[model samples]
Target: MPSEAKSWRWRYRFDGKEKMMSLGEYPKVGLKEARDRLAEARKLWSGGIDPLAERKAVVEAKEAEEREQQRRAESSFELIARDWWARWKEGKSRRHADTVMSRLEADVFARYGHRTRHLRTSSVKLNGS
Candidate 1:
């Protein structure tokens, strides 16, 4: 209990002849939520299911969702770059617009092709001569 007597720790007891379990700790896991989790574990244990494994599955699902969001960001670089060019062209001379378009299509587009399709179409309409 390392002096933090309030940390979530695995606890067990022997009720006469058989072992029983308890979840130790508070707000770190919250009182109500902790009770709910314990109720779930007890029910699952009675049914022969591992609560820890179930919790791990939930965590993995959440991690996958976060990874998907990151993929979208990486894939959106080209889109955002082209959108920036359109907004910038409004304030730039033709020569500046040409320079910006050349740099972006040459560098940014190739690097983020899969995500750049929609952006490329917008760029063509916005910069069409």
Candidate 2:
């Protein structure tokens, strides 16, 4: 985002409507930066995409990815377990799924609920190191 300078803002018209987008302040953004931004906007426009919409889409995607990453960090183990169970249970009988879930709760979740490092390993370590 650019700062405001001298009552002027970067303006462009799209679909018969005029829109203004802020580029940084004068001396901060200067002629080259404003030209660069205008060139970029024109590139997007030439590609048949609205610059503002494209920017919004990019920002939204980034925010969504960040939120998902934060959620995974917060409950990665549980998420992994649930995903595993979901895939494993597909086409299985309800009774069998219930029994398997109960056994996992008893034998796995309690011990590994807060300990996730081992969840990714293919075999158990024996050296205790």
lDDT of 1 by residue, 1-129 (tens): 476556444443323334334465665677777777678877876676565656678889999999987777665867677677888899689998999899888975675544623356666568651
| TM-score (all chains, Cα) for each model | 0.47, 0.50
Residue 6 lDDT (model 1): 67
Q: How well does candidate 2 match the true structure in TM-score terms?
A: 0.50
lDDT of 1 at 119: 54
lDDT of 2 at 102: 85
lDDT of 2 by residue, 2-80 (tens): 6534532667788889878665566767788888887887899888888888888999999999997676566756557
lDDT of each: 0.66, 0.73
How many steric overlaps does candidate 1 have? 0
